[model samples]
Target: MYRNNKSNLKLMRLLPRIGVICCIALLLTAAGCSRVEKAEKDDKILIGLSLDSIVVERWQRELEILVATVNELDAEIDVQIANESIDKQTEQIQYLIDKNVDVLIVVPNDANAFYDVLSEAERSGIDVIAYDRLIMHPDVDLYVSFDNVEIGRGISQRLIDELKKKTVNIPEEEIKPFKLLIINGDPKDNNSKLLNEGIYASLQEYIDAGFVTVVDEAWANEWREKIAKDLVEKYLSSGEEIDGIIAANDVLATGAIEILSKWRKAGEVLVVSQDAELSACQRIVEKTQLATAYKPIYDLASTTAKIAVSMAKGEKIIANDSIYNGYDNIPYLKLDAYVVDLDNMDNVIVKSGFHRKEDIYRNINNGK
Candidate 1:
């Protein structure tokens, strides 16, 4: 009887083990079904956006408009912001690729980086769109941005006009050559190069004619405010006479303005900038900065979102222009850009509903 009781105890233990195995099997089956269901849902089309950095106000606006547009299309989009890290961005792209995203939109930190990984994504049948900044990769499917070159030209032209006004009182022969400083954006950014190209093109005649001279040039890393401020301060402390500055973007412009304002030279030095950030517009009203090249963020972001969704749905993409990225004439959708000064700030920025009038004119009386 003791032996029989021991045998029953062993069977009871075996019964518990068997029940545990059955429970595990059921759980595994449920997990497999969940994955299959997710796979089926992913078939509807998935878009992955890798933003270089939204640390700037401009990029934040870009993200907001892009997400709103994607939701309107009833499409799914996953976004990853790299905050200006190439390695982190590469890893993010890989994760999206592993998720089998149908389309990948990348605003690359470095134009030269990500050619190989983006190529792999292309090989996997994922459409890649270069957002805002051009990705110098042959595998990139499309480039969407405003005319950066035109923005450069516009800002440069505005500087030249302002310089002329500042020099108009002097005799033609006695006019001091206008000394201009060039504070470019991140060297790794392709848009910086394009902006420089346009600026140089527009200012070449004046430079050659000796009416203007580039006194100093520096490239701000990552468009960091402190770096730009230090560069400008160092130049100013050296007792250099700076009549004008062509700061690549508003953030860099802010740095230069801070230094110039501290030195009490903000009114004398003509500063040209881009991005039309709210602070820059206020500075324009304050007459501390000159014109800003305003590229409508909503237009660029909404259009890019639409393209990504359509491409994900296997539709044809028609580009308005072509840019050769060393390997191919990559299709491009270039949008228009405008120069905004205090005079038309209302027409361009406020009327477009981009910014509330009260916000832009916060520091000024009706933006003067």
Candidate 2:
């Protein structure tokens, strides 16, 4: 009984200390859990944006809008510009992958260059969105862009309509066929291919009927204005009369117009292009360029940003269309494009706040 009492006393004395130790451990565990919960709550979704290049004016605008939208959603974005280099773009993508970004948005310089790296991104459970330009990989989670084919058709139709108006008073058979020179975008870009398809499709009937002739068709590598200028210069120097030009975008249009200006044919030859760039809009109002296909950048950038955020949060995305990328059909969200000309330039470009009215007409106003 004495021994039992002694042992009981010892245990009783140690019981409070043991209880205190247990309490401290429990409190530490609770603090650790609380910190983990707080960290999780504070974690922001990180989206990686890999761009082909920001050389085009519209791309910089698009980036601004995208950044604004992403910030509005309380997410983060890592942007990398590859400057139209395929190898550099691949390196940037690998860097993004290593960063373990929750989502990746790519404006691919070349559609076919990202299969392996993008596949690795998917393997790591990251969602991928192809922005403006389509990635040829099947594993791309989504594609967001404007209707490029329609823009092509619309611009081509504008050129055709203008040419028709010029010869409206003459007999159809008496009118000579219009000679058209096509300055297409980078051949590596899938959008360029689609645009070319739409351009050819629109001109096919007129071509077959001997109403139009494609005098020369050239692809500008990397959509470089210098290359387009050189090509136009060569054609003009060869004594080939170019009645009209269908440049793939504003940059190419600028190049063509520069050469035409040197030949004193700026306003004489009808030129149409895409991307409602400020210079192109200015040219439209100045009677240098006929029209520009306006693809709303805010709509495209905002929608892409929202979709990227939703994807990062593991939310469902609803796409109204799909495009086959030579591997499999991927979800596509296409926006509309409008033709901006002298008639509706204010309504489309200015009204949307894409470009200020004064800025677009700066030169014309100054001349006046």
Candidate 3:
């Protein structure tokens, strides 16, 4: 009986040991699962920014906005500027992919060249946003830009209005077609393409009714100033009667002005430009250029940062009504741009602290 009692106690002790082991196993499994869930939630979303060209004034502004905003959102980002080479952009994108970024923001050198990188990102469940330029493809997830058509039409409307305000000796009925020379932006840029389309849309009204004559329409290669200067010189050499110039961007406008200066054109050739870069604003105030479409880079960059933060946290981003990104409509947000002219130049650009009055007038005052 004593031996039986001892065996019973021993069995009871074994049962408690088994229970403790089972509890430990369950606890370990639960701990492992919790760690995985936390890891998924807490991962730092790596975002890569690939800017096509570093040469333009507006691009630097864009970079500053996006970088500041993304950092503010507590996510990590890597930015690369390709200096306008399509091949360089492609390599930069592939390099970003190799680094395993969770999101990629691309201002592509060409609309179609970066599709391969996008494909890889899509397959890996990474999100991609096309910035400034629209990446026309089937796979891109989000798009952010201003209403480019509106920007174009806006520029045209402003030009037409400004010209109307200028001195006119000809009778309304005897007015010939307002001769317009165009220095279009880089043909490959989707934004420039849209702006061009906008110009046509607005100009067609005057064109079809015979109120406007297109003296020359030259699309710049990579939107280079040298290319624009060369093309403008060629047109001048051709002896076409040119009146006004509608340069798609500030740089192009400046290039056209350089050529016009060689021909001693000031009030004779009205010029339309965009970006409201310090020089562009200065030119407008000095009466060398007409106006610019000022796109608020701060708004765009801040919004992008907010979205990046939400995405990194694996949270949902609210979609505005979808916009067609060439292939199909997708969720997007578009900001508006302002048109700044001499009348509003002090209020719009200089007062906004983008430029200084003394700097603008010093050169003209000295006559150098």
Per residue, candidate 2 scores C-alpha lDDT tens digits across 1-368 of 11244335435544565576556556678566665445444567889999999989999999999999999999999999998888999999999989878789999999998889998876666778999999998678788998889988999999999998988799777999999999999999999999999899899999998989998888988888987788789888888888999999999999999999999989898999999999999999999999999998999999999988987665677588999999888888989999989999999999999999889989985733
Off by over 4 Å in 2: 1-37
Order candidates by lDDT, high to low. Answer: 2, 1, 3
**How far is 359's C-alpha from truth in model 2 (Å)?**
0.4
Query: Would you estimate the TM-scores of all the predictions?
Result: 0.87, 0.90, 0.84
Better lDDT candidate (1, 2): 2
Candidate 1: where are CA atoms >4 Å away? 1-43, 366-368
For model 2, what is the error of residue 290's alpha carbon versus the real structure, in angstroms, after optimal superposition? Answer: 0.1
Candidate 2 structure, TM-score to reference:
0.90
Error of 1 at 295 (Å): 0.7
What is residue 135's positional error in candidate 3, in angstroms?
A: 0.5
Clashing pairs in 3: none
lDDT of 2: 0.87
For model 1 the local lDDT of residue 172 reads: 89
What is the Cα root-mean-square deviation between model 3 and the actual structure? 12.5
| lDDT of candidate 1 at residue 206, scale 0 to 100 | 98
